[model samples]
Target: MAITKIVELVGESKDNWRDAAANAVKEANKTIDEITGVEILNLTADVKDGEIIEYKANVQVAFPVREQRK
Candidate 1:
């Protein structure tokens, strides 16, 4: 049997929401392998002077758990 795990990640981008989500995936890919998918949990932003200054993404990353059978 195969098992998987889910972890939450927060990433930010100054450009757009897409980049923010991509950033989260990119960072997770660095240390995680077999990344099955990503789910956008929430979206948020930082405001300053009555304007959206940055974009933020809350995502759930999924990856398979690798273990040797004993």
Candidate 2:
């Protein structure tokens, strides 16, 4: 039997959407294990003074639920 869990995270980058999504997954991996995949749910941008300041991404991170050891 297998179990899975999903978590939503928002990441920001000054570069682009791809980096934002990648950063979100990378940061999540720091605290999580068995990261199966990431689904990009939404994309947006922050504007400052009529210029795009940063790129933001909403991501869904999926990972396997670890079974507790007896």
**Most lDDT-accurate candidate:** 2
Question: lDDT of all the models against the reference?
Answer: 0.95, 0.96
What TM-score do all the candidates reach, one by one? Answer: 0.93, 0.92
Pairs in clash, predicted candidate 1 = none
Candidate 1 lDDT tens digits, 1-70: 8898999999999999989999999999999998999999999999999999999999999998888756
lDDT of 1 at 16: 93
**In terms of TM-score, how similar is model 2 to the real structure?**
0.92
Q: After superposition, how far is residue 7 of candidate 1 from its true place, in Å?
A: 0.7
* lDDT value, residue 42 of candidate 2: 100
Candidate 2 lDDT, tens digit per residue, 1-70? 7898999999989999999999999999999998999999999999999999999999999999878846
Candidate 2 Cα outliers beyond 4 Å, as residue runs = none
Q: Each candidate: RMSD to true structure?
A: 1.3, 1.2
Candidate with maximal TM-score: 1
